[model samples]
Target: MITEQIAKDIWELHSRLFDHRPILQGHIRAFVKEFEEKRGTREEDRLNKIKTQLNDMTDKYIPETETALDTFLTNIQAKVKVAVEVCKKIEEKENNIEVGFLDLQRQRRREEWDVFMQEQFEKSAKVDQDMDIEMKKVSAEYEELEKKIEHISTATP
Candidate 1:
């Protein structure tokens, strides 16, 4: 799952050697050109290491996230399935709602289960949304990193 800490870490790491923020007027492509034109060979190894880490961010960490999110989403789906099954057992046809038929015991149970499912759904949705946002940020950073690496690669000669 894409925890808040991981998201923050991802942004922090990307910010170390490059700027990954919104651009208002200046062009990133032009900035890369200027960077390449001005870059010196004083610390080539450090630059290479940074490049490698960037690559790993896309290759290793991103895929690992996919697996983690897949598992997380699967678990959430299971919870939803259980909720649906339990909801089906409820005989109530309350319009625009999912509650059990009005027997004292069943009604109380219905309210509890409905509330539980609503909370689960909301929580799942939030996590999914956050994961998607992080994934987008990672993708944009990876692409920008690739551009920088290519510039460095060609400009070195």
Candidate 2:
């Protein structure tokens, strides 16, 4: 098929690019040019052909299968059931992985928030202690001034 042919071509190109020995600049340039040409040529035509073939196969095969004998119908039905089950399993696994990843992210964020709150609390406590010390010093100085005023007023009398 075209897809199989494309896969083979891609593998061939990959093998050439990843050779064990040192690759020359000239070889690299040649490969790049070849790849670009292949990519640029007839892409639209190739895609259209693929689409047309798929549509044709679907239109041609499905109704014929539906109207076929019992054995053929049974086989197609079995294949379809298997396909559906496999798809459902894949979807379930994907959902599980997503849920696990989200839970991990939430836990990490919670830890970060806890650390931030602890740091802020420590800083606030330090500020409060500093303010308390300053208030005590001011109060002592005020008491000393009051004692001096009392002594002065008694001596003048």
Tens-digit lDDT track of model 1 for 1-157: 5798899999888876577455522577788777886675636867999999999999999999999999899999999999998786663445325333346668789899999999999999999999999999999999999999999999998
Per-prediction TM-score to the true structure, in the order listed: 0.34, 0.44
Whose lDDT is greatest here?
2
Instruction: List per-prediction Cα lDDT, in the order shown.
Output: 0.84, 0.90
| Total backbone clashes of candidate 2, pairs 3 or more residues apart or in separate chains | 0
Collision count for each candidate, in order = 1, 0
Clash-forming residue pairs, model 1: 92-101
Give, for candidate 2, the lowest lDDT window spanning 10 residues. Answer: 17-26
Q: List pairs with backbone clashes in candidate 2.
A: none
